[model samples]
Target chain A: MFFNMQLTYEIAGGDFGKAGYASSEIKKVLKKLNLDLRIIKKIAVALYEAEVNIVAHAYRGSLTVEIDTVKISVKAQDEGPGIADIDQAMTEGFSTASAQVREMGFGAGMGLPNIKKNADELNISSEVGKGTELEIITYLK
Target chain B: MEAQTFHHALTILTDVCIGCTHCMQVCPTEALRVKNGKAELFDNRCVDCGECMRVCPVNAIIVEQDDFSEIFKYKYRVALVPSVFIGQFPRDIPTRGIYSALLEQGFTHVYEAEHSAELLRESINEYITEYEDKWPVISTFCPAVVRLIQVRFPSLLDHMMQLKPPLDLAAMSYKKHLIDKGHNSDDIGIFYVTPCAAKIAAVKSPVGDESSPINGVINLNFLFNKTYRTLKNNDREQCPIPEKEQLKDFEMTWTLTSGESTHVNRRSLAIDGIHNVIEFLEKLENGEVTNFKFLELRACDESCAGGILTVENRFLTRDRLHNRAKQYLKDVSEGKRLHNKSIDQYKPYLKQHINIKSIPARSMLKLDEDMGEAMKKMERVRNLMCFLPAIDCGACGAPSCQSLAEDIVQKRAAISGCVFIQQSMQMKNKLSNDHALRIMEKTWGENRFDKDCTKKGAKDES
Candidate 1:
């Protein structure tokens, strides 16, 4: 029989050091579930990039994750200047992160694209001045 | 191996990780992550390169090497020495002096790995020259680097040089040497004098398509004291050379990262230390530089001299090796001749490979389709983190406030598991049940915890 878990993380912004918080927690949850290795990795990559985005751009954010017998789902919402051009931001080479973030070895512009590649289904909604919300789904079956 | 099987390999000190993600940031395999205020290591994905062990500021991560007592079970012990051993001692000390010392220390046979290293070097260059169309021919000298490439950049497996590691090459060559003298292979136990713990782990559980040719590992530090005593005595017989031309020293020079660059007979870029190597290789994976035909990478800074397990100072070791290499090359022709002879007599050891498949990492995601419970847990995590100071000091029973919150939410831990949170609760006289309910109510908002969320019920009284 398969089991399900729901996890949550309150990611604080303005901290470059604590960037991958939500993603790391999700990885721990997946490990305990004994999901397929491939699916676990995909969820981890997508969720982590999303978390980093919130910390880098938002003032504060929260991550909500849902896991079941055959599938995993994640939703990240942040209070920040939402993405102006969703298509451009999703592009592999498009990045808006500052020089400081790059020095720490992040802001590679590959974050969004990598997230896209890892998730089975991904949705992003943003209103330039409002905020940003991301939803991701990955299936193990 | 499954993640469940390797669970014991995960070591989270809880207090010292600082949640910096330095290990996670640099891990080529993406086996680490920072949650809350501490770093968590994934067991299934970790290859145990000791990068975390080396980079941690508080010495929180630890990867221990197997003891020499493992060698006691074997009847015939053969010592396989890497070429870098030449960089360890003074130039005046005869190389065979070290060999004789190993004999006194219970090893039955000694082989200078540089002989195989030279042979492997020549073979790799020839392979590169023949397959010149293969743009970047990655060196196979560092087992840890090979693991990184295989795990993080699987598509670039074609870029790796087909040759086995020098120690493996030397072990196979020695097995053949013993066979020619009418000895059985199983009777002789081959032990590599390793520069790092990765090599020891590699010997125990090798990656990729090959099994380790050597049976065991002996760190340089463990063997140094005894060998040094022998160097002072100047007593035992010299190493039995199969050929008179094999004893020349330059063949032993490839101990450092740049050591292979010199032997490759071409312009090559050498990188040592973990962070720099990861960056350059990532660039390579992205096809950043196409012109550089050869690249030598080492995980430790100062090449092998700065290895994770070495006892000597890396800077001092580098200077000593540089000075000694200069003094040994007085006769350039002899150096070239010695290098050529070692190559002509090379042997390959091929063994049955045991697949070490990757395992899934544990998820911190929700256990049910209940968003209501997840929201409640998020609120709990938020409250804990606010009280956390974000120092990730790891004093809490969990790795971080985030981790503690996950535990609390999942019923694996409690909010009071956080010492800081508990202390704050005590200071405010809010450790009572009513205050705990109030803390939850305030963080999650009034309508936050629905009947669906309370389906699991509250397990922690606090």
Candidate 2:
């Protein structure tokens, strides 16, 4: 039987300073689990980019991370302005970020592209008026 | 995954330690714990920062050093003195007087540790440019910080520059200088006058490289006292030593804060103090802190001036080094030509030996080698954590409730070792009072609970 664990963190949007808290906590737990450094690095980048994306766009969100010997999974669910075009949003330099957000060094539009490159699998679903849900997974075995 | 264990120069003498928990509170890595009426070290977790020694009430923690007589074994004895060692002396004592004192203390020759700092800066700039992909190249100058990164921040291992620090390069240059002068390598000894235990440990069991060029380490505090007595003697024999070139303006403060960062061509930040470094590194790892091309991180607060073994105040030492550097600049502007022994001549050989092997990451956070086993232990620790108090009182001999739970899951301690759990068990008639007392006695030795007037700050402390 595979040993599994789950961790959840509440993310407050628009607070750029408080972003990446969830990613760091997840990284600490993964380090303690004796995971491969390369896998951990991949997870760190993907999870961090996703975590920052929610802060850069949404009003509020929550992150749930599931870790096991076979695979690791992270899902970011946020309640705010959602992406209208998924394919276009995934393109590099295709940022819809405001001047203020861009000034903060976030919302480079490389968020989805980075998450796509680092994660083993990526899932995205959203409504225009509502929030967006992003699922990112990486296999360990 | 690395088989080589970390070597620590600090020793906790149980005979002298009273299990006061002063040291247990200050360890940055949580490597120290009170056990059996004494503090014990977890070698892998300890980076030898010497913070514990700084806070120990009884001065029970000691940084080990080579015996003075040991230097006599080599025909050509060399003391590689760092600038901080000179910073400890009063401003009135000239650098030449200190050098003479070292010679009188059985050293045949002396070499300044930062003589290679000039070369080190050039090499570091080249390395930063060559490895452009690895932005924010972390300096490997501080050995304690190197070990800290190895154990705690293993993921950031790639960022650590493979280049050796000035001390290592200086030692290599000194050894080569002696060997080139027809002295056998075996007959030459290079001892470092270190300001902290971390340097002692680095010389003994170096990281990134196979072996250190240093033959031994002499703690700064011990050597300071030895020279202080010699300087006080008015009738002391004088050694008419040749005038060797002292540190240049930038080189004098090379070991101080902002020394490396001030010289680097690109964007760089100098972070001193172990806790500050940890906080900044946490942000860097999560991609929060960015844009810096290089980071010069030191473990001590004021860089080497705040070394644990240093006798003088850190601020005073820093001021002295700054003044010393200013004085050197004034001398240069007055057309005083610096004499001889230029380390710049050996750049070819120093460059060849400066690049160290890649530093491997060794995560101390892992509960076990296998991922499956580590997951199991993590689960057990989480389960145990629920019943334990989170106050982090060191009564359980472990540093905190979390660590005690971890120790219990690893079978190094028992859940009943917790006083709260013992009290509850006694209330439920599951544990006898005598049994609880025995458990405590086991954790903290017998008679540890007895009232003693000789404890720190007590009336009969003498």
Span of ten consecutive residues with least summed lDDT in model 2 chain B: B1-10
Provide C-alpha RMSD values for all models, in order.
12.2, 3.0
Which CAPRI tier for candidate 1?
Answer: incorrect
lDDT of 1 by residue, B164-255 (tens): 66676667767766776777777778888877766766677665534777877777766776678766886545543323334344454576
Candidate 2 residues lying further than 4 Å off, grouped into runs, are A98-107, B1-7, B236-239
For candidate 2, the docking band is medium
Local distance difference test, each candidate? 0.63, 0.87
lDDT of 2 at B64: 79
Can you tell me the DockQ of model 1?
A: 0.05
Best by lDDT: 2
Let me know the TM-score candidate 2 reaches against the reference structure.
Answer: 0.95
